[model samples]
Target: MWGSAGIVKPGLERINRLLSFLGHPQRNYLSIQITGTNGKGSTAVLLHNLLNAGGFRPGLFTSPHLVSPEERIRVSGRVYPGQLEKEVRDLGKRFLRRHPSFRKDPPTFFELVTGLALKHFSEEGVEVAVLETGLGGRLDAVTASEPRIVVLTTVSLDHQEFLGANLEEILLEKVAPDRGGCLVAGEVPQYLIRLILMRKRKVGGDLFTTGRDLFVWRNGKGSFDFSVRGEIIEGVSPVKGTGFQAGNALLALAAFSCVAGSVSGKRGERLLKVLEETVIPGRFEVVPGHTTVVLDVGHNLEAVKAFCREAGKLECRGRRVLVFSLMKNRDPLSLLRTWGEVADDIIYVELGEMFHPFRRIREVSSLLGVKVLVAKSLRDALSRGKKIAGSGGCVMVVGSHYLVGEYYRLEGKTADI
Candidate 1:
């Protein structure tokens, strides 16, 4: 049947086709939909982990899987048992055959994966499924799920072509319909604020934010400390390398407050336990070394700016070198300009063989007035970047999560020194 072989297409017909084959499983349960320019995956992970810990039996879904396609779905902290993959594949085949017209346009990889997650969730009778949008939120396959709670993490100036150049236009297209409908901690563009005010007059729903509901902060200790809905916990948040994770924790807490009243406390405790156990592979993930290595999956200008500012606050004094790579769709020059200030040198490398590399990493570096070196492979780039940092200088591996994931896989294979 029509699976992930064709060039990517939009519209819900193929998704509907796939779901029908799976017996319309997504409609079986409520879902928490997460959409944003960045941090959507991390936020979804946090919510899924905590909700599962609490006893909600949530099915978690996120995009651009670091390890495998199955990583996209988590049931009580992992993709369901191996036997289910065969079932999903078989079902997808049945789906494409059923819809001859829709089958002409195959479901993209993400759409198929999303379909499988929903199908699995429905089969397991999950309490809720945390669904993260793949890219632009409007027509994304997950939006068809009709989320009960829509969490819009910070909106920023990325995906300009697809999302629009300004916040007002983008928010209208990406995040307004669900206005007052459990809006989480977003960057809150001025126009969005205006649109929200307009929405409130009609009494559609109640919009929420960090200041309006909960608060996040950092204690002197290495762990994150934060206050949520008047409850304070030190080190309750444990996302690595991100100073703003406490903010995300607050966002999750607010989301729970808005909708999780039905969940039992014992189940809530379990969710907290799972959250403590949850680990997103690349967002601000740190690697141990004499000169510490930090990896962040911040590809956009705003996210990179945030990552750099937070990394600077760590006061990493050693020769700080950066391993930079990005996709063709991203703003490479803007990202370079933002990251250039934080590093003594940058080694540019491709995240994968499919990426159309920029021969201009050096030129962007020159434009930004930062030292740059282009390397042929991630191993070579990382090794050279480490050497450049010397004994005390810190090395930052960043730009794309793909680069970080490749390095992580390599790190697992090397014998400990």
Candidate 2:
């Protein structure tokens, strides 16, 4: 049983090394590499849904599954645990034997998991797979897959230590090496476009604005009336979360257009209806408990911004209680400051299961300008958060998907949190 700590690292070197020894299984199925600071999960979901609707067997690979690792690899919205495990075992056995050099490093957790996904997707004969990057762009395990289509959902300043100091540098590392046509949410940094042209000798991957291309203006009944467009065609997202979900939906629309030829406006409409009905648990998910609780995996500035913006719009008249934790690399102070203005009281807790340390939990939340409570653990935080919500107000738990996954683990689920 190789566990998480032994498996994680800086880049694709381990996977690349492992795959080269095993004969590169990632190339077997067409995969679109989805890279960005935010929206990777939702974009991957949209990509998976669109391809499945187009009569294609598509696999979706994402991280920190809201409920289970089974959520990480899906074909046509169905998770195949038995099939996934078989592929993982086969690949794990072979890769370990074949890559003696990488064995010293042990192919960090994400790299091993990615290898498992590639093997599963390949063995399943999936027509396509959406590979959402774990962190940063360059040297990530997904880069070893060398996708045919590179999709940038959006880039913002996050992951400062490994991804570089500024947006331009981050964009260069993320988008420059992209070999194929890109599909981006409109208006990436000017420098990123320049680098893409420099590398591929081409231009144009930008779609329309998030609000324009995939809009959720409002329905009279308090639900959202939304539409997502790509290449002059529009699809509706039935499952609504926040306005930023539009960006992810539109990213999917562009991906579908780029690969499958535009969806027949009629098929697309039906697809849109199907999409609107999608339920990705824990992502802006409003769970009906004793009090209303919204769970999100917003680990960075841009993601936190989107979640807080949407959280502010909720019609609940009660106090807004926030239970939060973040990774060491995230902008915790800045994120908490932003959440501070919107949330009524903040409950800070540690995510013990991640690569980060526990003290960072208190350090970051201390920067907030409001009343902050420190919980010994996630369960304690949830108990306190619920008490603060007190049968009336809204309780929001957010931070990293690691935090969300940790929550799922405490809830007694069968899969990886």
Q: Which candidate has the top score in TM-score?
A: 1
lDDT per residue as tens, model 1, 8-46: 455677676677777788889878888877778878877
Residue 236 error, candidate 2, Å: 3.4
**Mind giving the per-residue lDDT tens digits that candidate 2 earns over 227-264?**
44533433343456345465566567767776776554
Candidate 2 lDDT score at position 113: 73
lDDT of 2: 0.70
Q: How many angstroms is residue 366 displaced in model 1 relative to the true structure, after the best TM-score fit?
A: 2.6
